[model samples]
Target: MKSILTMLGIAAALLAAWSARAAIYDAIQFGEPGSEKSHGLESDDSEVIRGGLDEPARILLPRAPASWQGGSVKFKLRVNPNRQNYVTLKLWGGDVNENLLILHADGRQVGYRSRGDIGLLDYGSPEPAVPGRFYYVTLPLPMSATYRRERVEFEIVSTGRIWEPGRTFEQYQKKMLTPSRGLYRFYVHDHSYFKPPAEDRQGARPEPVLPPQQPESFEALKERVNRELDRLLGPDGRFTNQMQLLMAAEAAGLEWSRACRNPEAVRRIVAGLDNCYLRWREDPSLASDDRSAVYPAWTGFGPAAEAVRLLHKDLGPYLDEELRGPDGQPVRRRKAWADMLEAGVRHLAASRSRHPKQSMIVDLNLYRNNRGLRLLDPSKGLPPEVVLGCLYESVGLEPWSGPLDGKGKPVLKSGGSDRLFTAKRLPKEFGYDGNDGELPALAAAIYQATRPEPGKPGDERILGVLREMIRARSFFRYPALNLAHNPVMRLETVIGWRDMQFPGDVTYVQRPESGASVLQAAAAVLEPYSTGIVQQMFGERQFFPSLDRQMEDREFRTTFGLLHVPEHYRLLTAQPASSSRLPMSEGQPDFVFSDEESGVLAVKYGSEILYASLYWRAPHAVNFLARIHHVTPVLERLATVRQEVEFQPSGRIFVRPGWTNSGVGAGGLNYPDNVRSIHAGETLPIARLPKTAGTGQENPLAGRGDFYKLLYGPYLFAMNASSREFTFTTPKNIVYKRLPDGGEIAGGTVLKVAPMSTVVLRRAR
Candidate 1:
């Protein structure tokens, strides 16, 4: 009997140890390369000082302290008698810069503020104050804080300050505190009283939300895009006349690619090439009638300019100057004229491989990067042959042969200079009898120089070019891949979903099976990287940083899910693999499965996300994705559950006085299916809820006590989905609760949610 008791105690202790969980660290100050300044309201003031206009400040705050786990924290400026000057201060960030709450230092409550509220502080007059004065600034930890460290602003609103004749005040703190470490970031509160700060004053900031048009229906958005392209490209498509028509055709293909339109549009754009030939025939100035005669390729200057530079083996000069290679080398020039000629031959090879007819019109639009096709164009004056030579060296192609300069050696060009063109000089006084042999010979020379080394393997350039065309949008344009996509997304919506899964120990796996790509597609148009074509389009950022090690494992699995969080953390993908068991995939892994055994499941009730990952061997796994949206009720439910308990809304609900409760739950609804135990209370039918159920045993939560009963009280509504607005009454004891997709919900207010959407209902205060 003694031995058995000891064994039981050991077993209990082991179980408790096994149940312990750790929170993931949020890295806030990880300044993304170009992401630091997308929409302005600088992410941080780590570097900003007094008079630091146009200078960026970086602030990073540590991840939200563990204490903020289930609660929302509100941060605001607190004014003491000493620092109360007529200066303007602006605060941004919590929920996209909207002012959520305001409180006086002495506890004078101004109530919860909305976006329409004026919370900015402007100092019109300067006051004297001692240094190191402490100001009480409180960030209320409400029950719904998402990011660990959000950017805060404290701007000096008054341009000039007035001082009393008798005395002067210590100059205002020259610079606000910006984090140099940690992830939480804050920026100075400038531009609160007037125009936007300098950083945000540049080109039109892309909207946070994507115009509500689908990319599949490009018709509505394409015309506006084409017009913009036309404006950027002058009448003559090419920036110069040196490029051959075939090369010009290639350039045209690149232009079609930038728009990322349907293949049909790309084809139509390319077909217009024939029109260019006729125009060249009629316009003597555009393309000369005589072969080898000097003619301006300016007709190709419009959208195709980037392509024209490729013919000379150079891409865009400005872009080349901006983009840096991994080795920090400035890759911007062609070496020798021989190298340029070789590049021409390579182009010809790729062209012939695709069109068999030897049509010089290579549709690079279809090319993928892996094949070795260089779609990123360099600038002009560099010979294409030079770049070809570099490629030759990289792949061990063959021996090179081309004209040498004064020293009598093969021309070897380096990046950043127009060496190829500088080396060649046409005769000072040349005659154009329409048949100068020079130009075409140069073109032909380029073609001959690019022959593949004596039969090593298939042409990489050919394959690469073909694949690149098909994946134009993937290269340098995916919003998800770009760090800037974050701020761009934050501008429109308050929340986004980033799901991470690791099959191996480190690497994040984006299996073709998980279908997480759907979210990428959804965010494409909504993020800043998306071509701003639709009005309904907005931006929202999501980040999934998978540890690098476990990426390639075919037998990959992990136990990760979001649960117990306060706010509505959107779902990016299905749950990850169970903790104790490895996730398995049979058949096509990409298809969506209804089987809970396949992975985990997340149940969203109001703003709360309850997630669980199951395994045949392991007991269970749960995690909180964000702060619960409806906190009072959830806490109440949690309080009641002993080991497990059923979760449900409270009895008291609120909507507009006259709003009808008929047809309230019309869309796909997600709710708790089973409860192990129920706290006897007046259950109210707030509105019709779509059929919902739990995958676990019937009444999975039955042991819990009245901890779930605390949720019943007056409620507020947040209408999230649908646009329709109507009213209805609940059965005598029932009530209606509405949650708005945007804005705050008032107690007793039934927010109108359009048909086919979600609404938030919190127990009324």
Candidate 2:
């Protein structure tokens, strides 16, 4: 047989280099490489190796602590393939407790690529050849794995076994776990990751959250700044890395200093800042090719700029203070500040790959770092990529490539029913990234980057994004209970009625809590709903980290991009906070909001408030392909059982006659179906769920209760979170009433809701 590896390298030589150098030019950080064991010694078993017609052999990758960061494994093996009995491979591992390749990263939360998408040794497959002689193959490990220690694992399917036609690997593997009789052996060798760039990557300190926005008395401002100043001078404070506290000190510290008639406090702040500045500038770690550089740059720079601004008058002597950089360049402290700021900015700009086309890594540190740099070099501009940090574009909510058109007006989807407040981000009318926090974080960066100008807009386009985002997410708020008024319907991005499936693990219908942290602290635009989103996010969040870590694995950094967090809006501008918890209310003069693009209409008619999604948001790659939007994936505590079901929200239901999808396919493998089969009225029972995959009940989560419950929390408060409006039924209905002016029917379970809506009733006396 012709060989693919004859010109590449011999097996002996390939296996000899058990560890190779890092693959940095690839641009992704594949952690340090090289395996602990340096030998490719074959197994010493005396018996002849064999294979079972049903089960395959398992080969554990050599163990190395912290070394397997989304890399590949190269090994040598001796095998032969033919028309009938050829070898195939099935690689699998935990994406939670260990490393696993994460695919579909471009959409919502990326789907961890399930077992092996690697190689096959079938008739026309690429298996390094020599008939019965040995050859080499490389298996790349996944990034989002969940297993504890075994880090990486793979299998050998040489018996030419195939899961039943149309059956998935999930079902095939579930029914075939025992080691096969064909005990093949892999001569151990190299396990390594792609090389990472020299610039270190790390998270900035958590986005700072500030005190609420309430007009403060000079005395109050003085007291707060003075207290923060005290902490700054205290022994424990300097090491604490408290950026928020530091900014608070600046917000009113200057005034407080003047009020006390003491330049001493101001001087001390200057002194403290100078100390931090020099430490960061000279600390080789901050400027090195190592990982800590971005960390200090972001957390260190922003606060430093604010301090410098605050102490301008008092800095005559300090400005002349000289310092040496890590490179041994000596300059006045002011110039030194520019050098430090630029160094950090240049590094991040050089290293970061943040963009709409690639990853959703709106690193808060990068923005804070650049803001600090621009704060110094006023002529320099904020990175255009900063738009990603402010208005994120995910699988569903693809807001903008840039936030404006050539005319400099905000780019938004038309069809919002508001004049001033109705710029919609669902221009494409798609799903939402479950992270929820990213776009807000990016928008928050705009505030972090700009100084508050009276009538001037700082980076108008970016500011437009910030305003539009707050309006977009908060629009889903149903004021009375502060819960998600988001209108959603699944299409091809979701499961089909009978046999169709989308490409992603999640369709961008993000968690209601994605906007929670931002909601926790109110902002003017987040109004009416700032309190609402916060309540809604937290209310739903209580049900999870409910799924096991692996159930929905994603990039560690991607999680931080959700816009739900920004240090504090008050720090940016003094807009009053919606501090009051969402109060229950019937319509006062009729409150109404309509999103034509998203097909959502929210209306509060006195006591009867109704939220409805009249159509699918927009095009999803999944739905676009399937050419339908009838059936979606759903989970609810139904009139019968609790499980994830194929929902025809328009009232079409597919009822399977079984209690379990425990075993069905020829090899008993559970594959996803890509045919129109279920919708609103039908039940795609848990038993109907594939026997494998995240939505499947294959994992050890029995004690975790139902996975569907997390998504279908018709909570204790009569909140119906599912897609269908269910009768809040009771063993018997607990009745309630309204005053003579009350609008709707008295309620308990009698109240009805559209998907993700809520109803509150005052019980009758």
Candidate 3:
């Protein structure tokens, strides 16, 4: 009996020892609402889950102490179901930057520096997720001299899947007992001698947020500028490089010239500018080379052009002696400016294609025809319009090779081959489309170079071409086949749909499937011309005011171009008379409104009218046009509006609002399909028509149906809203069809409409 009792005592003692060996240390419960602030864990852009119906809170582990190194380590964790979680463990040596080893929950490990020299022990198996369950993972602790000195950190991340109906209790837990939002709870079980502090066993406080700074006063601003200048120009200044010093000096000179003429500042600026020009000027001998000698083509030509123009205008009289000829003789100030301009032009011109038929500058040697690969076929040489525009702008129209017609207008030579010119004419190769802003940009450059005066010989012709290019390339008209030929056109369509169909949030459009291409298109257009044609066009008041709509859209690239480019604001100072006006008699009406209190402008062509209202106090204004007398009152009520006029063959005129809704819930990723109650007596016009006929069959408006379709034009065009719905009254006995979803409006005096949706009415046979 005594021996049996002693055996039982020994077995109990051995069991107690085994339990102590399995004890967990440094445990963290993630979902406590206060844990985020209580713990020093930092989050990047990802949202913390915090315990919820379907989510678990995420916790980033703090850096481990050096004492925790050199042993086998095990991590026990509990995670919510339906989520794929990843935990990355990084072991650092001395500095955080000096990483020793990186271990992923997937069993992948990478060693860095001296740690790489030693073979890593295999971490058993990859961590697996058992729905709503706990899992354990073991890894041999890195105990090398490099690792013992450095420490470890944990980054826990999770992605959730959509919850489906009828899930098991384990798959979808109805109740969570822990305060920690559904995030994982973790504990470290280390075999090493090191132990964490008792206070740290709970959690650490979150980083504090800083308060915002107040605006600076005028005196404070002046002092700040002075300090910055000193820092840049002082003996121990950061601007020690020659380029930096020169830029600083030129800036100082310009500022002084504007505010108060400081002689010392002016002298320093002129000296710096001269030094820069001498060092950076293109070698005259390299003019024949096709490769761009200027390291960054833009910085070279842009600054040079600005400097020459400024020196000639502001300091020509004061520094005439500084302007020297190639022969080392002092040249006249104006003559020197002209010579510099001529030299720059010559260098650009020298890079042009030597082909007898080509004359436009070929800036991009990799692509033929100056990036207008579709417009100019290498076998057919340069287009006549491009050649004419370049020559007329640079030298004169006399240099053009085309034969003069009856009106003395140069006739385009098609290289003996009859090539069709139509909106649908695109290259067979997918990427060879000519819809890039490059064509319009080149046209604008040529137009500006023409130095257009009211009635110059080639001025009207150049302006006409430019105007056509802008209109044809613009999103004003729908593409013939709905196929986007290029990036700009694609962006136009995306913006149009967002503006018209989905107005409130762009998330639906921004999805990878839909919004990605739109973003790419915006970036492509904005990047190439933000500093060139886009700026110049805006400065010259040549761009349409409707473009301001892009500012309201949340597209990053579009917003960046509009905000980053300085010339976008030039429209504010543009002369109102410069707005394009189209004659109303030709079925085209151009409306211009002039009021100091409200800046409003509208241009109408075919079925569409582009309009914009600019005023901070009353950013919305209604414009009454003489051409559309019937719809003037409706037009006046809307601030920014686009009116579309459709004529049915049945002599019915259908005028409808074309702009997208700017209200909340109209612009997000999710589609808002619920109908809202609209007040009675509101007048609205349906602009889009059905693609199918009354027979419930597809209506192809080509061949047999074309004539009938043309005959059923718009006649009577007034729509009124009922107490809780939209209504349209037919003045004539005509059949009306709704668009998108094909349905006929029963013949009646008043037609009811479904609110918050696009409706197009067509005259049905």
Candidate 4:
């Protein structure tokens, strides 16, 4: 037999041993990409992967640690063998010819497709009467030896058939015999787990001691990444979400190659990338324009061309470099790819869907997709300089999000507005229109690095705009992601998923592999794309409230947006130039970091954090939503509408009516109310907080953050975001030092807070 690792093209890792447990490991999960488990983890309880037997879905699974005992791989599949469709009798829509699905494990048949009927699907197994679903097609894998040797390939092949959603195996159980053909659909629940050897175990399991990560040489990392990229880009580029991954992988590699000045790596990236593009161009399923594929990404050529240009070299006149242009004549590879990308970006820049709250949903997505393209090569579509200039006029942050105006409307900032949006009154083909909602300051970070500096005499106007936007990020981005993420919001939205109760961890980990985090980490495939980063994102998904939250749950979900684009993961990595770094003062925030525009201030000094949302015009104190308004159905809002960790005027605490009140839940205890209410002018060191009965504040613990799930630093915040004045009384025993003008006060003192301004009181010695 071939070497197991060689066949799978994956290297195995050593892990610590432990006593047997039910789910010791789960290396691959259905439905979810980028959420694989090997040891110490398992896939969340999401629905299932609907890769029909025809288009078999493939996953580059993590190796099972040697310490793990042998276990059985259990699968719950929904099979439909018999189906009929009166809709279309043509070759593409006719009955399925697949009567049997032969599963191959370690290149050997696990199911008897050629022999006995017992191993055949539904041949002898008692299937449900109503084409429902059955649990457990248990395939046992006992770790015969401790060498970590195991089957590297496992496949269930039954793809070539009429896969219509309504049909089932039980409908024609008897006809699952030879030569039968019909429409059919099958589903494998994504939460499949590997059950350990015994239901009865001997003793308690030992604690796993994970080894410290050893850094690999660039050469070794490149080789490893190339192996995975080869599989993803080939055999055929028809696997689910392959286009986005293809684009991101190649673009990121090329970016890294350019940054490192390694033209050799650039060559390697383009070879596979070129082939993948051609394969898709030739594939009937994708090229015919039916567009039914689950993922909606197609811009695989943008980053490759940009890399070549940056490297200052011409892609040699190799005859093998094949690409057909719109005129049916051969053209430069850059021209062809650029042509298609321009079209896609054009449509995206003009998109106006708002019914399903597309603004909140697709806004970040559009920006994310644009990132992989990076908008660098101006050879095709809009001129690079022109595009940046227009984006300058179009993108804006207006109406400083602090207190309300005298007329009760939102106020404008002296510095600039708080939230960002595409500005009004532009000619066609300039400025996008989604809704009057959250735009991007990150765009400034993006353009700043990619474009030239603005302070020069000959510099274009766009550079000045980039400089302006970069500064604006300081004011708003702090509250943009976590403001509305409080206990009440968590119960209904983060946990309950804004009432979208998807099975298992579906809501939390929508597109595990696709997001800003994933894209940015593209260049880091050197260390990340394979290991800790992927799983860590999954772990953090349940709590984070940004685009990194993979919220694309359910089957037929189109990843054609953010998940489908290569992200911007190179934020903290090695810099290409001075522009690569944002100009914000990271080490200090004056004596007290304040932004009049956002009224969202912070003092992140050393390891300590002190944040305040002093004044917010909209009651947008806490929102699980990405935005407050929708464009199409004007004034339509999206929110988890829940109470917060508030400090009411009366100081009494509990669930505040109408998204009111403030409290904190950290380390699984409800301790936020300890701030209590002290009158505005009375500064107290120790606060007289309300008492928790009996067992004391039974609630989930989360360290640091307020109302928003994740813990951020603030000893005890003055938790009022309205235009009105409020006071914060510190808890007993803890004292705070007032900021800007330092003055120590006991924990029970009530610190007065002014509207539309920032205040900080540090924990005193």
Give the top-scoring candidate (TM-score): 2
* For model 4, the run of ten residues with the poorest summed lDDT: 83-92
**Worst ten-residue run, lDDT, model 2?**
632-641
lDDT preference between candidates 2 and 3, better one: 2
User: Each candidate's lDDT (Cα)?
Assistant: 0.21, 0.30, 0.27, 0.28
Task: Write candidate 1's Cα lDDT for 1-765 as tens digits.
Answer: 323332332333223212222111111111333433332323212233221122232332212332100111123332211110111212211111111112222122211111101121211111111011111111211111111223322221111121212122223111212122111222221111112233331222223332232232223223333443343243444322222233333323333323333333333333333233234434533321223322122112221322332232323232233222234554332222212222332332332111111111221111111011233332322244544443332211223223233222344442222211100111111100011101211222123223232112324552232222112212101111112222211010001011110000110111111201212221211222222211111122122221111123222111000100101113222222222110111111111111111112222233332222111101011110111111111111100000111123323222211111111122112112111111112111122222342221112111111111111123222211122443422223334433322233443343343442223343322
Candidate 3's residue-wise lDDT over 1-765, tens digit each? Answer: 323322332333223222223333334545444544444444532234433223344422222232211112223333211111112121110111111112222222311111011111111111111112222222222211112222234433221111212244233212211111122444343321112224322221223222223232223323333454455444454422233333343344333212124444444444544443343334543223313322232122323333333333345445455555445776454334333333433343333332211222232211112212212122222343553444443222223333323222335552212211112211111011122212443444344333322123334564554444343333222211111111011112111111211011111101112111212212222232222323333332323322323434544223222321222223222323233211221233432221111121223333433222121111111111101111110111111111212222222111211111111121112212222111111122121234332221212110010000001122222221112344545434556655323467655557554432223444455
Error of 2 at 225 (Å): 6.4
lDDT of 4 at 218: 39
Kindly report which residue stretches of model 1 are placed more than 4 angstroms away from their true locations once superposed. Answer: 1-94, 98-215, 232-251, 254-306, 309-765
RMSD of 2: 22.1
Worst ten in a row by lDDT for model 1 = 559-568
lDDT string for model 2 (1-765, tens) is 112221122222222112122121111101112211232222311122222222233222322332211122222222211100011122211001111221111121111122111112221111111111111222221111211212123222222123323355643322212222222222221222111123322111222232233332234323443454456554464523324324433433333243133555555555555565576655634532423222443333544554454445555576677766556777777666766655554544433322321222223433454555555566553554553333233212333332333222334544122221113543321222213222454454444444343123344454455655554544333221011212211111211111111211211112222212233224423444444434333333421221222224342221222221223323323344333332222224444444433333344444443333322211110110001111101100000011111222222112221211221111133324211111111122122222333332222111111111101111112334345555543213434432223443432344454555444333342
Q: Could you give the candidate ranking by TM-score, starting with the highest?
A: 2, 4, 3, 1
User: How many clashes (backbone N, Cα, C below 3 Å) per candidate?
Assistant: 151, 73, 39, 55
Descending-lDDT candidate ranking: 2, 4, 3, 1
